[model samples]
Target: MSSPLKRSLSTTGRSISPPPLQRKIPRLTEHVSSTREPSVDQLRIFSWNVNGVGPLLQKQLSFSADSLSPLRTFLKRHHWPQFLCLQEVKISSKDTATQRRLQAAANQSAAGDEPSYTIEFSLPRDKYNATGFGGKVHGVATLIRDDFGSRLRATRRPDWDLEGRVLVHELDMGLVVINGYWVNGTSNPYRDPETGQVVGTRHDHKLRFHQWMLDEALRLERSGLHVILIGDMNIARARIDGHPNLRTSPVQHVKNRADFNAKFFTYENGLSAVDVFRHKHGNRQKYTYHPRGRNWGESCDRVDLIVVSRSLVDPLDAVAETDILDNALDRGHSDHVPLWVALDMSIFSAKAAQSGSD
Candidate 1:
């Protein structure tokens, strides 16, 4: 965190101006014992699809340049959730006007308070490798609070080979986060000679992305890292209420269209048992994606997801909460809402019985 800003005289003694959004994370005074269960109270996680956050902020905050403040403000206002992660991010950091605009959003979010994230980015080395949504960079990032980032030795999946997507952060909590953005498959089509019919495109590129992500998950699993693969999967886990063939629908009707579902997200790729914010509380959330204007007209599905290692499968099953962030527009100011969970480490960690078993 940066130095606190000076206070101005207001009708009240408190300063009227909020402090600048801190780009740097704070230093931790202590570390959790690896042998003991982590202080769960100290751990909070958040994830979102900001839909190319730069433009979103620019529109809302009057920022001409892409700024970090709106992003900062969002995090702070949301009580500064401790373990922050995001998808669909922008790569540019040069626009000072926009930069100041971002800072302003951050200040508003913080309300002159402190923000916990120590922001970090893993950008494309070659500009050509980058992907964009509506002319803005489409990437991912992790905003580990100071303690989390410092304690965890960060490593990323290879940047180039990826479909402009990345995740899998090694947590000091003996866990690894499998963060990702599955490929989006969409292309226009024209009626052709073979069948004399027209068609649209599906996830041909994403199939590759999912395979790569699964391979990364398996590599971590092989290295003995406890893993939790979470983020936008770009696939539905089960058959929707109405589908032609249900599980086997995509086999023939959709030539190159991918299921992106758990059954097929990655076959030779690596993962299998994805523990979606399961419907344990009631039903897992449905409909991960939504076009702004087509709400009432389109059928919905669950694409954003959480897949834990079989090692933690049963445990994650015990404390998971997967749902579309209803406050998507308000709290998130994002298109993709957050899907969150609560795990009872007591069911899986070493201290479960030791703390009380003793």
Candidate 2:
């Protein structure tokens, strides 16, 4: 079955026509910024599922030329310092126009100021094309501030990177930030002929992806690098992570819930990861995604997450706070809200030194 979301461009090799610019929403006019500047010792990282960058760019055009683009506006307001991981960008790397638009937006700054960010992208190609959404399938992207971008030594896992699901950047600080867009489980399923069980669904693929991430996390940890994994994981860990009213098959939901729990709670070699937001907020009923239809009765889930290794949690918790950016006014941008954490890098001063020496 095809996805419910529409593609921005057609598969017939036609150029995309820009959507009509609508009047700027009142919320867009508000000027907001973080309470503090991101010093060399601190880094503010953010992640969001854009749904589709092509459509988002079109929306940005509707605003006044002097105003900041939607993405930049969000970054500035939240005071995102150095790193941004965007999932479901929905544009191929071959699409130079869209890629350039992202670059321009990342570099965009106040008048007479220089651009701040340099970007890297992972695009899906060939058999790895997870999204069958015509020629306009989605991908993931990582944008680093120019200052930090210069320190990026290399990208690990070339084979995985080609799937456009993961981008692991190896920083000179011996830190690795992985931006991932895990596969959304298949919607349709078939029953087994002999056992009479539902099988061959997308959830199977999602399970494999989760296992791969677990392995990757361990490998990175063993290499002695501080790791930050963030993106739209597309899995709700428990009943609290998702609205209870959403319709789902009992077996599928149960399996998915267990898979999510294992991914975060299970330990390998005595090491496990923690969900930053959940750790900070506890049992907060906040959600990062509000599915189609504005009806409150519909199901919503906190699938977008920021997970960090246990080693970094202590330092992060010392000086940082995490929250779900669920502004109702910004709901028009995408179904998924942005999730972020602000950390004073100074807390990591000791750990940074230790990692550097390794």
Candidate 3:
């Protein structure tokens, strides 16, 4: 009935400036002198599995305030995002020898017009507590393009180190960015230790993660803040999202069998779910995760993602799609392929309201 209010809509996505590009070795540039506004719309973002950023640092990457190589190049050339999120950083000390090695990688890759990105990382400060369902420790970082950093800003959440799997960076773009990495495989692993039977280890893990995932989701829901939950959730969306599973793998989380504890998480059509990637060009495949073997790989599941709130999707009228970026250089980019992204959040909010009433 009333005209919708026009507030600043922060375009949410990472700058190569986000931690991923930075931990690789964010080049520190001389502060450019300028009085200008940062671009908010038409944002760019990237998510990838860097294996472990630790080993590379040990090589040529230096940890000092000085700039490094390939890493700097990678960020410079690729520093397009208002923000960036990187997985598997192998977080170590600020003075660790590995920093130099990582710098070397950056030194070699720096290029292009992206010298504006200021890189930062989310390295763990305490011992990883694997005592939970998932193992402890890993790196998550954020990068800010010079404009975004000067115009907008970014910071990691204080609570993330406990899990060390997710990175929450609030960007100047106005949206709170949650860059995440759900545990690969289950923690309640192995068949019943005493039964000597091969139990459905993955099934047990699904339940655990589902609870964790939903708990996290509800927190977002309660905040009523604009949010984006992107990263590797580990659960295959094909088996859970909008489709029905004709076959159920004879597996279940040993601790909590019924995963959709309706009390904790949200589900679509009897399955836990989240939307991944947006499709404008339309050649999305069914698989996102892959097996080590090529032929007969795990083509049946969809895992890696760029998920947002159900509320955001409804209003934004956002469409979903997935691209499988599997290449030789990607051999060790984690067990899953990188997912391409496209989103139109501006149109989602209105659509979301209309859909909810019906």
Candidate 4:
């Protein structure tokens, strides 16, 4: 069999200057679509924790005068992906300035024409509700190439979705893709104000997020939809996934790791999906997140991931390629590097054909 095709951009001796913070953010209107159609047999999906869209857009505009839109520049930098998933967008629906900026950036073409991407946003609502991140801290967005996006529909649960942490979309082809920014439990133990009792609000949220995600995936599976789950899971997941190994001494941290293993990775009773990237790379020490102010490689974790249901596993050798984009680190785009997976479209298309024949 042929080797898995590598489409990652080279990160060799090239230098990209740090974007000037003072540069005036350029206004970008519509232009010709920068994205091209993928091979009929292949589909590509990309995910990144942009840190924040507002700042990322400014950096993109600073790169070149010709940059028409953030999506355009982004697609050009990496070969265009059919689906682009972003986390930690940090834009709230109430923040009109940033909201408008994001809208402008996403609409990368003439106003009268169809935009290149069909964008979906899970933004924090305007108020500080218990279920939300107070309209600022966390958000997620997904941009599907218009053709596929047009054929998709949203799936949501009020509690899991209100914080703008989860965005689920189902395609007409019986596939569901979940883009998530799982809760990162607090660094310190929490205490109730009045009673002074330990109350792990953030930690509880993290566990709930995991359970919710597992339930959603299972539900989709029972409905006969294949699932592709992607984004910053916030858990380094294993000793091998982190430099110097991640701390498991904390009871909460240990619980978190165990929970993830049981619900998602365990063979006997878990979701039984494959962490496709890891399956392909097989113990390679590459990482996706390097905490700010920390030394790269020396202090990092591979928290970003791409996972797919069991049905998709057999096609891996012939149809899939996964990569952690090191070049994104060179550009200083965000603390998290872009992670991508390419799958042959024929896998899905064949299933569709079979169903029709049945």
Candidate 5:
């Protein structure tokens, strides 16, 4: 296999100044006319576990200004939703240059005109202490088209926001979009040296985090706002989600499988969400993550996902166009491919107007 793209931002040893924020928020009602009837507008939303943002932007910059890189090409192709949610960005708060580079890249337009998107990052606080690639901080980031930024109100949950795991944004259309990166619970079991009995494990923490996400989703639903939950959930919902040939220890496999099923499919009190992609394409055997050369009996799985509440499911389903960017895989950009969906935004606009009139 060809070498993956380099992961360093300052490999050339040149000090670069941070780029100024250039996003301009427009008026929320500009897109809607008072006399015109609300019509369905195709809104495309894309999600990816970028693994790291610095290296990804470095790869994009390697291309000449006249030429489009894979990253740029992917972003430019889908013109519908214009909103993006990214996970496992692995960027730290202190890395201002890298952050600016990412912001510029995401906002850049193909026509060399003013940027179309505004960017926000929920990066980890301490680069030196976080656990990941070389103790680098990893968190989630979001990008919204500049037109929608005027209607967007973003806040981090007081209890869950500090760790850079969740970002909540409410649009003036009465819709809420959440971007999240759940903890990967893969640590080895801790055992007592003398008795050889398993003492503890990180698996429990992972399960608890999953529970927290579910509870938060429910809370948002009760508040009467339409919700779109998208991110790298890090849990395979069923046996079909993973490669059949890959094998884990029997005990470990059973516990993880059970947890994933209950969290995603078990509906409590008639409140449950639907996985948009899976609902549209059932048992298709598509995997989002392909492990690179480290096979302990695991090769591929579908960990990344996009799910929406039941209230919005019918409308989303009517106009949903979902796909995994298979061609972008193995290009050394990331282990996971991008998953995207296009939905009709007219539904939300109509609902918002009706509520306002009441």
Candidate 6:
């Protein structure tokens, strides 16, 4: 059954619940790991759609500094990842006061001095975005461990970055991490502001976003960076990625999937960055999203993914582990579960460095 807090959002032309008008948006902290930790050489990355950070953190608009936020606890239990990317943050960039409170809270720790993570957020611009009474409707955030934060640089394409959906973080290791929340063509008609007439849906916007993402990834790879594009792509690239069966729109849906293949997947002579999860776990009947009020296998899809440049693959890392964490599902935190990928950073050793330099 769906949780009471479920917000309606459409995927594959199917309507899910919408977000609440107001909720607390909390910042995250970390503690010593309670679970086994990844080795020093292992670079673990995690992506999750929290739906809203406030509910997951058990925080309220009052801004009480709670030490044991569910998110902080979850990080401890899972053995804190080096980089954590989040989607559908739903916090308005227009709400600077709330954002200030969040940053202030994030700056605090048990020691009351040192920081835990260096967080960056991409939120919808007020001038032109989907804003409700509360503010912006969608956003994406990336949190890098304090120690590694210095090694990172962030960028976004202005064309689609205004919506706060795409953020590209470049590391010195010739690795570029593109964290995105792809647009979902809700198919709901909206009145055109200029024409003052009811017009088409967001289908074109969705397609353009996907195309921009593809172009950017390819562009980075050509510049000698190994790309790791991860997030809620919202495109079930294949029937295997979706449970039961993928919903279809003979014209739009089919073209969307085909364009995804022709641009990103290797099968269609596209970019070299392959879906790391599928490369490691082929044809596995697993999923990263399960809509509320729906059975597990009835309508779930592995929309979340970690696609990596082939050059980053090697025996040591060989994509050590790729998992769709069900713990989030078990907790009923979000309709979507978290996806994690473990890769050995050593893959960018002297030999790889020399090759790139050449």
TM-score for each predicted model, relative to the true structure: 0.64, 0.80, 0.58, 0.79, 0.76, 0.81
Clash list (residue pairs), candidate 4: 41-345
Model 4 clash tally?
1
lDDT of each: 0.47, 0.65, 0.45, 0.67, 0.60, 0.67
**Alpha carbon deviation, residue 340, candidate 4 (Å):** 0.9
RMSD of 6: 5.1
Segments of candidate 5 deviating more than 4 angstroms: 1-40, 59-70, 108-115, 126-129, 132-135, 188-200, 246-250, 269-271, 294-298, 314-319, 328-332
Model 4 Cα shift for residue 49 (angstroms): 0.7
* lDDT accuracy of residue 119 in candidate 1: 49
The weakest ten consecutive residues by lDDT in model 6 span: 1-10
Backbone clash tally (model 1): 8
Best by TM-score: 6
RMSD to truth, every model: 14.0, 6.7, 13.2, 8.6, 10.3, 5.1
User: lDDT tens string, model 5, 1-358?
Assistant: 0112211212211111111122111122334222122234766778887666655463444434544433454455455246788877766666778777777676544565533666777876432224344434447888887766787866564364444777787876657778887755544453333455666654654576667777777787788777778888776677787775433443554566567566656746434777877887887877777543444224566778888777777653433567665432221355676787776777766776887899
User: Model 6, residue 309: displacement in angstroms?
Assistant: 1.6
Native-vs-model 5 lDDT? Answer: 0.60
lDDT score, residue 219, model 6?
A: 83
Q: How many clashes (backbone N, Cα, C below 3 Å) per candidate?
A: 8, 4, 56, 1, 3, 7
Candidate 2's residue-wise lDDT over 193-243, tens digit each? 345466665566567677788778778889987778888886677668767
Clashing pairs in 2: 41-345, 42-345, 90-138, 186-202
Candidates 3 and 6 compared: the better one by lDDT is: 6
Per-residue alpha-carbon lDDT of candidate 3 for residues 1-358, written as tens digits (9 for 90 to 100): 0001111113211111112223333223445221122234445555665545543343333534434443343344343445556665655545344544544454443446444455566554433232221222455655555665653444554453344566666543335567776654433343433454656554454455565655665565566544666666544443342122312333332123244334223445322323544333233444444433344332334545666555544555443333444432232324344444444444444445676799
